[model samples]
Target chain A: MLLFLLAAAVAVAASLAVVLGRNPMHSVLLLIVSFAALAALYIGLDAPFAAVVQIIIYAGAIMVLFLFVVMLLNAHREDEGTGGAALGGRPLAAGAALAIVLAAELAWAVLRTRRAGGSWMGAGPESDGTALQSVRTLGGVLYSEYSLAFEVTSLLIIVAMVGAVVLARRES
Target chain B: MSSVSTIGQALNGIVPVMCVTLAGIACMLAEAFRRRGERMPIGGLGLVGLAGAGASAVLLWGRRAGCLGVAEADDFGLFVQLVLVGIGVLTIVFSSDAVEREGLPAGEYYALTMFALAGMMLMAVATDLLVIFLALEVFSLALYAMTGLRRRVYASAEGAFKYFILGGFSSAFFLYGVAFAFGLSGSTHLDRLAAHVQAHAPAGGLLLLVAMGLLLAGFAFKVAAVPFHMWTPDAYESAPTVVTGFMSTAVKAAAFAAFIRVFLHALGPLRADWLPVVWVLAICTMILGSVVGVVQVNLKRMLAYSSIAHGGYLLVALASGDEVGRAAILFYLVVYAVTNVGAFAVIALLDSREAPMQTLDDYRGLWHRSPFMSGMLAVFLLSLGGFPPFAGFVAKWYVFTAAVRADQYALAIVGVLTSVVSVFFYLRIIVMMYMTDKAAEAAPAALPRVPKPAAAALWLSVAALLYLGVLPTRVVEIAARAVASVL
Candidate 1:
């Protein structure tokens, strides 16, 4: 648990460093670290399926696309002018908002935990066997109790597919 | 696995989407198989597919709720789906000429459009957070690609890049919010979340608020509200005019549909906590969107700002959070969609080539060049400006009245003030059209003939605007019932 917390903190700091870093490529690498950390957090939350999916889809696929595009576009921070530092002033505003959010989250966590009295019961002990079993159960519930969502998910994939094609078509 | 038992139920929910997916595939095949010398099958198959989707949406209306693992279907989802499908049809009709002019492959354009429409329908009808996220990506990725469709134009490429980056960032925030909600409530279903929020009440505190706020920020960006609106102008201006038309209408509607669903259903009990945040968003969107529009020389950029204002007005209805408020949103969406599309169609016709004639100066002496087209543009613009005896005014009236009825009188006042402020920009174009003299060669060198199908869309939009504006009672009654049934 201590290792996980430390890793998560390191990941968040790396991500901030990436955003604040002067080099775009360095920032990209930092974002990858952030995504990796998020995946770990998802795993620790007992949603290994989501964690793996996040790594594959977001970290592996989407970020690669972003990198390819950024490199192909050959964008340089120098070309963009150091307009980013001025954005730092806005950071104070962002920090205030973040503080409020953190306060609210802390309060909710305390209250909900107090209300539940630390009940860590899973939905059912019978399904507490394996990650595979959890995935199977998730799929089962997704289709049986949540099939409408499944269909919508399929539709979403279709839209993304088409969106890619349409948006990428060559000009006449 | 629960696969076998739910297959039947799943198939039931899948048919409508399947029809579109199959049609898109068929269009691709036809495009590939066609003879080299022959014209591509542009209008027929794509139109038919969208038409079929629309028909199926109606056919499946009220059949049963919760066929598979989905939450359920109801009047609200059905109504929103109908609106989305209708906008899809309109977009295709309006784009027929514009696409051809730009030398875009009709097959890819039509397929993506159908796919995006399918995603939107899914989004409007979805009750699951996971499904919503997927649907968002489906449509957004499609839009991002479409924004960069004109690849040689560096501007389009830049705009697409911006949209993709920001869109991806927002999606991440949205996913984190969903994760928090699932962590807190143990289920991502709207009904379940509502129950949890109600049970927990004020004590649910920061976690729930964070979840809701993150979600709000995500939707605010999608809907192009003030602070999150940096991407709208550039993306809209750079994308093909037809793509912009579709994005502004169909995409905006889908986003708002999901927005209202989440707020009204999942987060209702925590209204007091989030209401102030939304109130500020509403005011900023209205003020900035309207005031900023006045300075835009580029017509597309101007319309982009106006869209932000429209989003603000919709926010007012959402913040009001009443049956009437909900109904007002639905009605306003329909009217706004029609009027905005009509305006864009006119803009598309006013320009000759892929190069945009969007500057305010270019519109001078438009009245003398094409009387009918200019007049049509006037009607649509007037409606958008909230001018009376036109649909825009009536839609505004309904939304403001709904706000007042909900005891959100201050919001109503702000809305009205913004509407009046917005008129200046809308009239700026009208005055340029009618009052100014045609500067030598100020008008477009040549006006393309308004194709019959495109004309039909414009006429329909104008007729709907006037019809709904004059007699909103029937539509309002229907909208009210639709919203009430969902709640």
Candidate 2:
């Protein structure tokens, strides 16, 4: 419980900093921190595979790409005075209201699940508490049951690569 | 030996897609090895592959084969596969001239097109949500690149950017819906989902509804149904005309194939909950598509809206939710694909780098400039307007009949009314082509001759439209049998 709270708090704080940071570089770095905290939360929920993927993909590879893009674009601190007043006047209020409503709905759902004693944290038929996060089981299922999708994902990636080359290549 | 035989069975289900993929690879290799500025008949290679796919699909008809539990080559899927192959062949044929005219890289153009067609064919046949999503991404990525293939053109880039961002957003929505569905039923297979829904009808409740709605949003975006169709006009308008034809028809056909399977087959039990929502969507799409289309002057943009309204018609068929409705969808997809591709092929043939003709005024007195081109365009336009003795009329007639048979009078009425409104725009184009005199000062110095291949394809498409219109019973029976295999 304590670990969960700690990870959750760190995630929330880092995410808030990510949104609030003026410098684009600082925001990206903060997002990595938020992603790490989320990974920790995932670990607390007994999803080690998801947690590892979250750290590797989101915090490591994706963040590096983000940093490269930020550097390439030479992004700087956002100007606060440009359109702040106009955005904050009505749209901000409505956005905040909607956010509050969404948060409330999420909280109510979680509370209801807790009251019902439902295992909202990976307690389905396949969970079994142990083998759920095992890479061996995952590989077996992926190769046997989900092989078609796994193979097709390779085709999807090839298409994406070809598309990138097509769109980004010089017109010589 | 048994394992090998099982593998062979799996391979059998995907032979058509594999043929196309191999051709795409061959195109890539040819592109890499070719000398700079050396013209290659890459489109011919694509045609061979498409022909192979079509032949294989014909062979696979009525087989109902499954691949590794995720993909299936059911008759319904094979029928759509044949249509996609036809669209691909026509696109490649039409693109033979446009490729050089527009200075598009031939290898990338044909390769990407082959890959996109393969992905579309896979989408039609996939029985698992994850596979469908992957297939969607494959084609969508290829299409986004194709849309921006003219990298120097600002509108092309802008349109591609909008399509990519919006397409990514919809894909995320689709993945989310898949997750929700998995959460509810603990499986993503269509048959499993159907069984789960059958067992837990009305009990899965809100989450099931949310899943259905999200999935519908993804498909609606692909089909360019209203409220999710903001990206259609811009993307269609900016893409190379031949590409616009391919995506507008093939994508919708593939997406509709999956949409019908998922919504009306797997989630059919929850029809009471979803039917009213689809009814609302169908009405809105028809009204908005026709009304907004009436104001568009750009030929491609006008067709984009017309496609959206056609999507509305398909949605009406979906709402009807019967075997007749399913069969109507199959028939309509074929008719719409041939006719729309033929129309866009005309636009491509008429377009010249020096004189880029796209506007309504550009079409004025086109009959005087090139009588054959004008005549072909008139046939396409009249067919689009759902005139008698054309494919579009029969397609729309089947859709309306399906709706009426299902007791969806309001949807049928709205569909008929909006189609009537849409016909005005189609006729407006035909009128401009035939009636208005070309201003002497604005006359093009020289109109490009229609490439022989494109001209031949146009003639074939027109012949098809006439055949389907005048003697529709045979194809209608085949379509009915196709849907029967699935339902």
Candidate 3:
């Protein structure tokens, strides 16, 4: 519960900073922090595989692309008022209210389940949804059952590469 | 079949696509090897690949094979594959002069076109939603670059940028829908999705409805159906004329093929929930396409609207969801591909760097200068306008009749009325060509000298359109049988 609370707090704060920040670079940094916090939450939930992927992909690769686009778009200015105050604070208030309602609903569900106290989450002989094992099975199924989609993804990448060259290459 | 290994099964199912893909790779290599200004027949190489794929598709007809249970080489897919190959070949045939005239990089252009065709083939055959999405990305990426190939042209870059942004957003919506569907049902394969949906139905889940809505929105954007069609006119108008032709015909064919398989075959049991939505979409597409089309002066934008209206007619057939509707769709695709590609090829010839010749005023006196080209353009325009003894008339007649037979009277009446309304624009072009009144006084637009390959493509398309229009019986039966196999 403590870990969940810490991760939730960090995620909420970082995401709020992402939207409310005056500078695009600051927003990007806050978005990265939010992703990192989400990854930590995933790890806390026993999904270390997803947590690692979230770090490697979202926080690493996609963030790098975002940084590149930001720099390319705003090379002349270090900090500009891109997401300025025209986006009023009203939406944030409504958003906070919705978030509180969602949290309250979650608490209600948990309390109701506790009152009805069953062994639905009982420690039993069944698999406990091991993340590592699930990832391995996913790999196996992707290679065997979904090899078609896997191969075609390679084709998509090639097309993307060709497209990048076509769009960006300098003529002699 | 039981004894067949997975590799062999995949090999059997993917032969047609493999042919085209191999050709794409070859074109890339050929482009790399050629010296500057070396006129190696790169486009010819593309045609050979498309023809090989076409031959393989014909051989695969009536012999459905599943590629690892993901892609299917069914007659329906093969039929669409044949149409895409035809579109690819004709586009390549008409592309050389445009490529040369623009001083564009030949290798990239031909290679990208071949890759786009290969992707379209994959989309037609893919039975898994995952594979379909990949195919969608493959073609979308290639076409985006193809649209922006003229890097210096501002409109080209602008169009590609708008298309890419919107295309990426729509793809996200589609991916979200797929994720939701996989969560609701345990698989992304259409066959498995059908089973799961069947198991959960009449008490349909909200999540499922949301999934269908997202998926339909993605397809509607792709087919340029109204409300989601904001990108079509600019993209079509700005793309090189040959690329526009190929994109409009081949892209729409592949998209409709996948759309039919998903909505009609997989989510068919949920038709009650989705039919009214499609009905409204059809009505809007027909009304808006025709209404907005009448005001366009640029030929490409006008054709773009016309294509949107044609897409509505196909959606009308889709809404019908009957045997005749299925056959009508196949027939209409063939006719539409031939006529639209031919029309765009004429546009290509009339276009030059010094003079784009896109405006209606530029077409005046075209007949006096080049009788043959003007005659060909007139034929295409007449065909597009749905004149009797032309392919468009037969296609529209088939579609509306099928729609009416399925009790889609409103769709039929609307479709016919729009077709009549659309005739004005088509005739406007023909009148520009045939009037000869303003031939001397109009702008001295320098039409590109008729390239041999383009003329050949025009003749061939004209022949195909006439064949389909006059003798619709043989092809109609064949289309019926092919679609029946899937059902």
What would the per-residue lDDT of candidate 3 be over residues B313-387, giving only the tens digit for each residue? 989989998988999999999999999999898888778878767888778767877789889988888888788
DockQ-based class of model 1: acceptable
The regions of model 2 sitting more than 4 angstroms off are A1-64, A67-71, A74-133
Give the count of colliding residue pairs in each prediction.
Answer: 15, 0, 0
| Ranked by DockQ, top first | 3, 2, 1
- Provide per-model DockQ scores: 0.39, 0.62, 0.62
Question: Which lDDT tens digits does candidate 1 get at residues B301-339?
Answer: 999999999999999989888887899899999998888
Model 2 lDDT per residue over A1-172, tens place: 6877888889899989977777888999889988988988887767888988999798998998999788767877766675457466687788789999999999998889889878765433344567354966887998989988888888887888888888878878
Q: What lDDT tens digits, residue by residue, belong to model 2 across residues B430-458? A: 89988988856755768878878788889
Best by lDDT: 2
Q: What is the TM-score of each candidate against the true structure?
A: 0.79, 0.84, 0.84
- C-alpha RMSD over true interface residues, model 2: 0.7
Two-way lDDT contest, 1 vs 3, winner:
3
Q: Which stretches of candidate 1 lie over 4 Å from their true place?
A: A1-135, A138-172, B1-15, B35-37, B354-356, B442-444
Clash count, predicted structure 2? 0
